[model samples]
Target: MIIFFFLQSKIFIACVLMNLLIALCCFHFC
Candidate 1:
């Protein structure tokens, strides 16, 4: 159960970070 939560949060954080990075890159180019 603890490990599942840890992985879930990590994945969520990673997704958010990647989303932000993609938005920033698009904004910079456009």
Candidate 2:
């Protein structure tokens, strides 16, 4: 249970970071 929760949180953080990175790249290009 603890490992599952930790993995889920890590994935959520990674997704958020990825989204921010993509948004920044798009804004920079456009």
Candidate 3:
């Protein structure tokens, strides 16, 4: 149970980081 929750949070962080990166790229290029 603990491992499952940890993995979920890790994935959420990764997704947020990815979104930030994408937004920065769009802002710089467009």
Could you tell me which residue pairs clash in candidate 1?
Answer: none
lDDT of 3 at 17: 100
Clashing pairs in 3: none
**Which tens-of-lDDT digit does each residue in 1-30 have in candidate 3?**
999999999999999999999999999999
Candidate 2 backbone overlaps, count: 0
Off by over 4 Å in 3: none
TM-score of 1: 0.93
Candidate 2 per-residue lDDT, tens place, 1-30, comes to: 999999999999999999999999999999
lDDT, each prediction: 1.00, 1.00, 1.00
Show how many residue pairs clash in every candidate, following the order shown.
0, 0, 0
lDDT of 2: 1.00
Q: Against the true structure, what is every candidate's RMSD?
A: 0.4, 0.5, 0.4
Q: Report model 2's TM-score to 2 decimal places.
A: 0.89
User: How far off is residue 3 in model 2, in Å?
Assistant: 0.7
